[model samples]
Target: MAVYKVYAPPAPPTGGAASPEHFVFVRESFSWAAFLIPLPWMLYRRLWIVLAFYCLAAVAMALLAGSELAPVSMALGVLTPFVLGFEGNALRGWSLDRRGYTLEGVAEGRRRDDAEIRFFTRWVGGHAAAPQQPTPGPAARTLPITTLRETPTGIVGLFPTAGTQT
Candidate 1:
């Protein structure tokens, strides 16, 4: 099952809540597209800051590859895609946060649409319920308290006695 982080856009300055249609569900999992083609994926997601950092890292790696640190640079180049695949969703979430989106809740399902359906069904149901006052109840009774030993009587694990060597 895939887990998704739900984000709702910021309310308008006129004081109305944002529409439900604008909510974004970001899948919390590795992205194969991000691993294979990170730049285009970031571009599609509008992750400008992450893209900028990725570009800078690419440039730095290229420069290092031409210098004495070629092996290290090559290793980093290979590792970058895996890191992008792992962190792509998280980066997207961070971008949404920066753009004034509030984290609504988490949802889980086999797919994005399924996750959205599950989340919205619960969300709407919760909001539709009316608040009720708590009914008065009988006074609670307190259980009798017991004291515990301040010190151990013996070794508590595999050893049977306190001073016995294992």
Candidate 2:
């Protein structure tokens, strides 16, 4: 199953048709296209900062490799694109974050469309976590009270226990 990362676009103005259902799912797996065409992929995604860093790194590598470590530089040149492929999603996510996309959740499926469908099915069909319901009785009326007591094991507290659970 391919992992998918869900994103919610920035909320619209207070009066607009804003909704939780308007979510987008992008595959969180490595991109073979990005690996094969790093520059073009970066351009397509508008990953300016990442592209800048890549260019700078390439230039530095080229300058440093002049004649001393051609093989090392050659290897790095080949490896960089692969690294970009593996981290393409992260780069895209970072760009999305910068552009006001919030990470909502993650899911897995057979493909991007399938993953999106699964996420939406869960999100919109009541399969996701339900809102907390108010408990019955006076639990809501009274403020919770807690006390700490020293035990043979250690300090115990969140609830003032009359005794140990055992």
Candidate 3:
């Protein structure tokens, strides 16, 4: 996997005090679904517990007007914000913004203490298009490996030069 270290401005210090700190940001990869799916399932699981209220509403609506409207209203009530929240989480690739390092990427699960987030991203043309550069820090270093693989739970590294043909 390729890791680039880029500088970022830190957030304002807490307690209305200023402190000197340097931070770096890195990018992890994700597919489009990284922000979709999972919403309906999570919502559906929670919705089951409220089935009683839905039953009552259905009967009430039937007596006042018609049963059809109850299902529609109930569906909307359960789905609207749930979908919104899920989409928000998916699109917002998980990140760790801290004293001096930031990692942004999509991962199936997170390790404790936000130590690492596993995610997958692909490089075009099956390889980097141009020569890469070493990031400046305490020392400059080159990435000996290139491709990072994604599993349902996290990332697994494969040989940098060993990936499917683009």
Candidate 4:
């Protein structure tokens, strides 16, 4: 099952709740496309800041590749895709947050649509219920606090009372 983090945009300046259409569901999992083609994936997601950082890293690595640290740069280049695959979704979520999106809740399902349906169903149902106040009741009695007696030196086992050594 896949888990998704649901994000809702900030309310409009007109003073009403944001539309459901604006809600975003970010899947919490490794992205194959992100690993295979990070540039296109970032472009599609509109993750400008992350893309910028990625470009900077790439440039740095490229510079290093031409120097004595070629092996280290090559290693980083190889690992970059795996890092993107794992953290791409998280970066998307961060982008959403930067755009004033608040984390609404988490949903789990086999697919995104299934998760969306399940989340909205529960969300609507919760909103439909009317809240009720608790009625006053008689005060309950409190239990008395008791202190245990200290065991004498060398005494052991579970006895009703502390025992002294023979």
The lDDT of each candidate is 0.86, 0.77, 0.38, 0.86
Tens-place lDDT digits, model 1, residues 1-166: 9999999989889987788899999999998889999989999999999999999999999999999999999999999999999998999999999999999888899988999888887786223223356865677556665333333544444655654456
Compare candidates 2 and 3 on TM-score and give the better one: 2
Instruction: Highest TM-score: give the candidate number.
Output: 4
Give lDDT tens digits, candidate 4, residues 66-160: 99999999999999999999999999999999999999888899999999887887776223223356765677556665434443343445663
Candidate 4 lDDT for residue 87: 95
Q: Write model 3 residue lDDT over 20-118, tens digit each, in one string.
A: 232223333332232344345335434332334445654665564445466766666566445435443322322223233233222233331132222
Worst 10 contiguous positions by lDDT, candidate 1: 124-133
Worst 10 residues of 4 by lDDT: 124-133
User: If ranked by TM-score, best first, what sequence of candidates would result?
Assistant: 4, 1, 2, 3
Greater lDDT among 2 and 3 belongs to 2
Query: Could you tell me which residue pairs clash in candidate 4?
Result: none
C-alpha lDDT of residue 7 in model 1: 91
Per residue, candidate 2 scores C-alpha lDDT tens digits across 18-91 of 36566667687788978998889889878999999999989988986897888888899989988988898888
Clashing pairs in 1: none
Q: Number of backbone collisions per candidate, in order?
A: 0, 0, 1, 0
